[model samples]
Target: MSEPGKYVLAKPIGEAEIGRLDLQHRMWLTQHHGLYSAPISKSSKQRVVDIGCGTGIWAIAFATEHPDSHVLGLDITLPQPNSAPANCSFAVADAEGDWSFATEPFDLIYGRMLINSIRNWPRYLKRCLQHLKPGGWLELSDVAHRFFAEDGCSEAESPMLRWWRVVFQESSRNNGIDIDDTYKHAQQMRDAGFADVRERVFKWPVGSARASTQEEKVIGDLQYQNLQVLIGGVTETAVQHGDLPGMTAQQAQILADEAKRDVVENSDRHGYYMHFATYVGQAPR
Candidate 1:
């Protein structure tokens, strides 16, 4: 269990491996190519650390693919795994801590979708730098914008967009996160003395005719599902902060229903887009 005041529970990935969670994982894999791609150079003897590794899926995959490499997943939560490869291990660690377990430097460090949970980007980048071996790689990926919609599909006047903006802004404000920005992670890497920085952006077209298959539809579904989790918390915060009029529970439900339709209709009339950006840099040898 996570200590009191921790923003999240410190359980293993297995503990959180529910069906919806699995769907999110698959969608993320599809959305972020770098998560499982050839772009990453692998040395058999290298050590890799996955920061904020939830459920240890990515860590386990890396361990399976590179038998000689060591993979460690550190998170506040550790899912109880049916089995983990000999090369893979999961531990409880807070990203804001000293990272005391990493006595030696790691050859690669990875973090994904962690912006909303972190307060200080520069401090986090500095800590990631500290755990890296000379010439080690650091990769950071996150959603640049929330609730993307096609140009003029959902106008500023659209209730769905208005609800989303208010919900996201208030929730992020309450959580000490800057949701509007976090895309400039490349700049953060450069400031941390990392070199050879590169940034890649991927677009997950949601609710658009542009998506040609069921896989795309599944992605859209997952986006809406995850959005549901944030909506309540965000709206509650807005109401409490006096930023929004207190909406009845029914009103919340109606907004969600409308948003779902907007997402499921393949609205060529308008489309939803999810922005995924990744920044990769190398620590100087």
Candidate 2:
């Protein structure tokens, strides 16, 4: 059961999480062309909803950047001692549950890095469709569970892949929400009646030491920083499911550390990266 006024979430929450999410917001901006992937015109007055808007960083930034737009950030819990622009506000909500908090239709609904707790893709997307104005857009972005290496980069895969697999993919399934099924979200969106669905995939490097370009090096370093935070957060969850339950927290963290180390020490050799995909679809006019 979740706390009163809190959405049931798999992620651990705290001050550290807030900082990591803010960092992730910055990292995402460095990786993407803009705050979001969908092509919404700047001049048009818009109503935007950010699902799983951790720390309200993205929503706050989006509202501040596009002052003409009204951006509302939604999550299971809202941050305390938080402040936002006049056009930006936040509320507590679970995307899988009640959306009645959104009194009116939205022009754009965006969800970022929230593939873990969502169980029903098509149903949830259909709900998003129902909440959208005609021709409105839906955008979702997340990193998938594969860590790959290019030719001459490394002969073996990074052990970090194992950490992601067991912690996110395997453990999520044990709780009845399969993170791997995110690959099917685009098709599921189409089945839910979205139109002109498109997906963009980018290879996001794991560590800065091996990147060929300066920009990539910066992003890679950011990625490494985020991974360290994630490992610390997920260690307990990793211990709870799969073959790891009953292990001490320190033991679980040890495994997580090993994986992170492999990424740092072997980034040059492994060319370590995972696929970061952004899915975009529009409600029918």
Candidate 3:
């Protein structure tokens, strides 16, 4: 386990990790429609809060796009650049803590890729709702983390995929976090008293073999790089967590290498992809 006040994930915060996170942000922008899907840009003078903001990329982009809006990017450990857009600010804060920093209600509260870190969905959603202004939006985007195969490719037959599933599931269980919370976003939002909830799902291809168009091919290439970084980041943590039976860090790295090779070389037989969900809801006016 990591030390107190550190991120739960095994990966250390560094330049390489930050670069990977930025790549992920770009991939999400390409996968989803722009930085966010809420009806926030339609109005001016919007105050936005980005919960669990990593590297502050999304917040900076949103602030750049909506100069009239002031964006607050909050994270437990701030790795954001020293210089930011005039309308954007990065703060060190925990999403699960008392949100005393939010002196005023925000027009939008956004979070992405927080499934691995957040422990309580209901409480988090309630807090988001409480911090939101009436008619304001709360948007969340997360990957399911479960791999799937279409076109007769069986991911179950891949040892890498199987190891990933078991180890990650066990890790989440050990940490008391929900690994499949992406599926529960809508229900959680509704239960938190949010209205006009909407959900969008997207499939992210793992390799270029399945891509038919130039854009999809580019996305696949990026996804492959992202997976490589993910393997490096998670292997140590997964082994330390002892989720995989009789697995050492070296053994986990071997399996991760095989899995990455499968994505790159045997994608035709593996055809792996992940499902990402984007959920948006509004505080009742």
Candidate 4:
């Protein structure tokens, strides 16, 4: 478990966070090219569970795609549970806490961006393994949370990078949840008895100013907006959990403002992109 005050919802459970969560769902679709990339069945009897289903967008979409299948979306809290398909339902549950709410095995189990939220991944993967049907499929995703310059423009480093490093990397390190472990997810899944694990990397460009095509521009715009929300949310996290000593709120804000400006200005320059990855694996029959 994280420190008493370490884990915090970046934004409260309200309209603003609801908007961000919904936008985040849409952004991932563009990044991954679909609602799902795993080869899970769309059979009428198929059963799926979306771990950490925020607003139930993914669950609602999946339920629509497989009307005969029952889809359960689980999260600690959902801001506004939209009127979902008859096959879809939402429940308030913590993935890191008791998973007793799950009564039976599932055909496809999906988790995404949870590496940032959950603490004990090995145990979580083990629980996922135990809860899966024989030969069930599992798909997971996470953000690496660092910027990269497309061109050799290392001089374009910004305080945003520092803040990111402090909050996600250093803080996670302090809390024993190294965020950099994102790269080892496939292996971890394998260690947890998952088979045929594969990891696919993706890039999120920060702005559309340097996009070469229309699709790229659209994705860029979405990603830029994501960063804007992220910046607003994570700045406090950095101050609180980042283990940065003697940093005042005023100091942090000044640094964050300059960092946002740098990100905007540098976008027109060499261009920076953030990388994330999705892992697909299966339980052995």
Better of 3 and 4 by lDDT: 3
Model 4 spans with C-alpha error above 4 angstroms = 1-21, 152-157, 171-176, 209-215, 240-243
lDDT of 3 at 92: 91
Candidate 3 stretches with Cα past 4 Å from truth are 1-21, 151-156, 212-215
Question: Distance (Å) between predicted and true CA of 134, model 1?
Answer: 1.1
Per-candidate TM-score against the hidden true structure: 0.79, 0.82, 0.86, 0.84
Candidate 1 regions exceeding 4 Å error are 1-21, 32-41, 153-157, 212-254
Ordered from best to worst lDDT, the candidate numbers read: 3, 2, 4, 1
Model number with the top TM-score: 3
Q: Write the per-residue lDDT of candidate 3 for residues 96-160, one digit (tens) a residue.
A: 88898899999999899899878889998999999899999998888886777665554466755
All candidates' lDDT scores?
0.67, 0.73, 0.75, 0.72
lDDT (Cα, tens digit) per residue for candidate 1, span 47-163: 888888887877877787678989999899875777889999999988887688787888888887787667888888888888888888887767765666666654444556666
> Highest lDDT: which candidate?
3
Q: What's the TM for model 3?
A: 0.86
Per-residue error for 96 in candidate 2, Å, reads: 0.7
Query: Candidate 3's error at 125, in angstroms?
Result: 0.3
Can you write out model 4's per-residue Cα lDDT over 1-285, one digit (the tens) per residue? 111121111112233323545555655666655567677754578889999886777787777767798999998886366477889888888888888877999988988778767788888898999889988888887777466777755433656566566544555666667666777778788899999777777666778877776656767888767777777667777676655566777777776776677776766575777777788778999
Q: Model 2: residues >4 Å from true position, as ranges?
A: 1-21, 151-158, 209-214, 240-251
Cα error, residue 57 of model 4, in Å, equals 1.2
